[model samples]
Target: MLKFAKYFFIVFLITAILPLVLMFAWNNSQMEKFHNAMAKSAMSTGLMRLEYSVKTNLKVQEGDILRKLYYILPNDKNLSHIKNILNDYNTEVIQKPIKTPVSFYERKNFDLYCVTLVPFDNSTKGLKISKPVSLDLLRPTGPYTIELRFNKDDAAYEFKNVAFDPMAFGPPKKIFLLLSRVAKPHYKENSRREIALKGEDNSNAAYLTIELAFGPFRGMIDSIFTSLIILLVGILSSFVIGLIIKRVFVTPVMALSKAADQVKKGNLNFKLDASSKIEIIKNLYENFNDMILNLQTKEKLRESFISNLTHDLRTPLVSQSQSLEFISQKFKEIGLTNEYELAESLAKNNEHLLKMVNLILDSYSFDPEKLKLSIEKADLYEIIEDCKEQLKPLLAEKNIEFVNNIYKGGTLIEADLFQIKRVFINLLSNAIDNTSGENKYIKAAARFEDEEVLITIEDNGNGIAKEDLKFIFDRYYSGKSLERKLGSGFGLSVCQKLIDMHNGQITVESEINKYTKFIITLPLSQHPGKGTKEQP
Candidate 1:
């Protein structure tokens, strides 16, 4: 039972589980790689958005600086209104500055509301601005100069200070301070002050780091678990399916195997009880029944052969015994004077025994391998002429007319000359014996086709029955003989065997009471160097 289970398990693994497992592993791995790549791409796209926002903000700020400069130098009322409009624009459109708490500080002893405009410069070029100088005093009817200072970098910018309501420009000091602190740690001590004014520098890098750590990493974990669960479900389903298939299919096969074993042990009486739903098993069962029927047929043939052998042997023996008894009684009466008559009787019985023994030997020689053929290149027409001449005496005794149509140019074929001559002789003899009329005739013809030679011997004699034609070449098959005497029934079988040896063929076409024609076809050469075998 363990052996049977092991066999089924191996089959299951090969046919079902192994393929499914490999596919699951391969698909799961690909899904994992796909999820990881998707998460990484999403994070990269988000970082690109942040960088684009920063660059856009810098462009807006540069435009604002240029507008402010125009308003100071020209002191145009139109320029002042433009600055007011710029201040009303949303902060998101300008830059991504930090949101900070709004705070108000009053400068001590300054009657002029000291509105400090933090000079925003993103350039790294070295330039300096001195303390405040009156621009109107220098140019008369122009803007005043305001001092801008960076305490850490010791850099200052003196820009024209135009008078306006500080309330119009919202307080950006708290927002700037918060942005500066966040931005400072990313730069060197000396560069921090420069970078603080340009708020676009370090904001993009911080957002990219946050997205990678939080968003994509969480997605990777979720994708891994999902793929693993799918793989587990596939494996479990394959196992269940394989188990059910083994029970349905393998069980029937095993039962058949056991039945076969019992049959081999000489138990032909055993019958299989395992009925299966599989088509293959059903076919096997039918074939097993056919095998048993064939075995029974063979046993019957064996018994028949033994019984026939006894009857055949007894007939000849009984005839010889009666001949001996007659010869003894005659010798006692005539006192052995008429010796010649006694000798003739003994010779007749001896000839009968000799013929039986020769028939048995000829049956053995009908084996293809046992017959030694003297194969050579010879004229097939010449061989047919020789056969006609040798059998002329027999034809004359029967007053039968012989017709010869040996083809011109004499067809050449490579064949066993002596064996082919014997084939013709046997066919001609059978024809002579079967012919009945005084006008009995035998027609022998030869023709040559491309690559092959054909020789036919046709007789206007009593033909064979349709049912008897099929078994005519079987050993010892003698159909209704016209003479009512049995010749050894091995002639046609010998012809078939010899033709097969030469890689040629023999066939008989006959209709009852019409005529029988024997057609033999041989190749142009049967050289030992060019041996051939019969096609299956």
Candidate 2:
């Protein structure tokens, strides 16, 4: 989740937030440049007013030079009468030629306050020094400031008693006085400007200096707040996007991963929760569902092929067993009973083989169309007798006694003779496989009851577990594991299908290591309420 959140945040930054920052920077820079141009015009006007105050108003001329400083109020008009203002006794202190011509000072008064300077030329000089200007113009009681210097060499001025000054407040870390030669100096805000002092006249009056300031600091402050808002929004959006990503992308993908694991474990029937609001995941889910269905179809086809192939293999074995039976009888007629025994053993084994083959085929033969039963009237007891005879070798091998108690009267059943015989043989063989110990016996009896034939095959053998009896009729479900390898786990399954086709029901009852009984109820056609035309 954290990984997804991280990636989502990055994507949001690139796709959504980056443009906001770029646009803000570009606009802030452009506005600052435009403000500088406007400030220059305003400063040009201030310079004109100062030049008029010096040249036409004060009107002192030729070689009038002095070097002394004094603070004067703007209302003081005595500046027009003061003589040799620059060439006074202070001028004799260090007589030298004055190269720089223009000068100015910070203007702070009862009704007005402004920025003192921005960027100025080297040829300009500082000839005027004004009182300290308060920067907290929005506050009634504000910090005081003053510029204290008179040099034209560097055109740089130093200030005293800034509001944040440590001497007056707390600690002093550092202060900023100048900016380098990039574009603007010191600052570029609506609250600050650059002042330039220049004129054509010299010594006529106070130096004609121009004072201006850059734009205010509010624009920069607004930009900073905008950036902070964008940062906050970007962070908030990152978390929301992270959750969306987990739902739309991560969740479904993990489900698919678990589905893959199920498939690997051969669970083709494991269903996927493919529902989704995302278009891409919906498509993927549909494709995966199709894939699982295809695999099931393929598996069914493979099972059907093997089952049918087993049926084909059983036909030749049946014929070979009949041939061996005929040969065994001929040998017995010649009093060669020892030679006849081998032929009889092979014939019975062939019968067992046919029963197993049929069981294998029936396991997969769920469709009634695949059965192809040729319904005809046949003696049920006679078929049971024949199936018993076919399994005589296995019975003898286990020393088990087989009792056939099916009635010889009204023993007619409208059933597929071949399939009926297969079922009878399968039941007898299964009993023989399970029968063990001395005096092991299996009994088959049939009786007419309520227009149906009740045929039961009971055995005193290694009986089935009660839990296993219920699943005995399921395809490939064995009553006991002992008979599993020999019987293919499909004897009772095949019997149940054959009985169902005859419109009859088959059931079993058992107790472990005691007795097992299988009851088959087949509808009799020739009996009172039953008829061949109606069904089995």
Candidate 3:
């Protein structure tokens, strides 16, 4: 049980640790991917914000003052009047703009405006204002023209004479600033743009630098820490679970191991007190008990075999020795020239010895491989006939009636002919020996069924007991008492082994004091590869 527990612990340890390691590795890889995506998104959002700030500030500077004026005006002007008013305002604002003084601080209040004009009549619509507009207004009627205008010192300037170009701003700040911010020692020329818009009096420029702040690093760290904490908790939980399992399952198994060791050392009385809650441990306990029972049975059989062997050997020896003594005494009483009587005594002793030796040899040769058989295609009826002929003298002596019921077409079977003949002879002899009553009879029959031949040998003898029938084919297992005139207990066992070698089977049916039947079935000249008819 302890050994099993140790192995289980090792398995649990490996199972628990491997997944955590894999999770940690996977977490690291996923973290890297997440961090990369966050970084890219942050960079993109930052760039978009920078562009939006520039456009928004420029629009605010341009529209704030003009929108106020447009809201104040009443809608009373014709197309020509509106154009002239816008043209006059543009000239006034641009021409008088020297009052505010262009400077870096004041540039925040500056603006640019763009306008597109559409004609009320839809004719002569190609005319667009050529000048860049800080603020633009449209005339509401006729083939109208777009006008760019801006305010300075409560006066508006309109650039009516200038032509509009899409790139008329001349790099934005250069047209408006008076000085370059990059000319300062602390300013980086490539890192930010600097411009000076030329004016009649002064110019101003401010650097617009692009800088990126690390936003996702903190988020990345937080995610990593969270993942690590989750993984740690999972690993700890798994370890605790594994430990609990080992205690509940492994401990009982270890107990079984110690008990098994005691059993191996011949301590059959050893018992395990381990908890039976575990199915494996309970199964082990049952198997251990069964093994002990089998061992005890084997020990009893060994003792019986030894006693039987001794008795059998002693019987033959005593018979031979007594016969020799009787012969010597008879010879003295009769004459030295009595050759016939001397020969009879000698033959009787030799026969007893031969019978004992043959029984011993038969027991040894009951092994299936040891009995080499000459197998061939032989007629089942012919073998049966031969066996009957050989047992005819014995039948006559015992006054036993013999009946043979062989099929019309002799059943042909592929088998070891010599071994099968021995089988038939043994069965017949066993029946003859056991037969009693004045009308003692034996019956042998063969019939074909479903591509196989079934042979049955039955006799009107004292039938086998129900208990003994189960073990009739066991080695040295004679159903009859030892005192009976039966040969060695190997006959049925040998027959069973021989039949098994030919891929055949034998069965028996018997009733006490009525009859005993031995049924043998063999494939009729059919190999295993050859298909047989299905039995109904």
TM-score of every model versus the real structure: 0.37, 0.38, 0.38
By lDDT, is 2 or 3 better?
A: 2
* Candidate 3 displacement at residue 106 in angstroms: 93
Cα lDDT of model 2 by residue, 78-179, tens digit:
433222443331111112233433332322232221111111122132222122222232111212222222333333344333345321333222221111
RMSD for each of the candidates: 21.1, 21.3, 21.2
Clashing pairs in 1: 414-524, 414-526
All candidates' lDDT scores? 0.56, 0.58, 0.57
Over 444-495, each residue of candidate 1 has an lDDT whose tens digit, in order, gives 8877788777778888878877777776776667766453222566777788
Per-residue lDDT tens digits for candidate 3, residues 438-517, read 98899989887898888999998877777777767766566664322335667787788778777789999887778889
Candidate number with greatest lDDT: 2
Cα lDDT of model 3 overall?
0.57
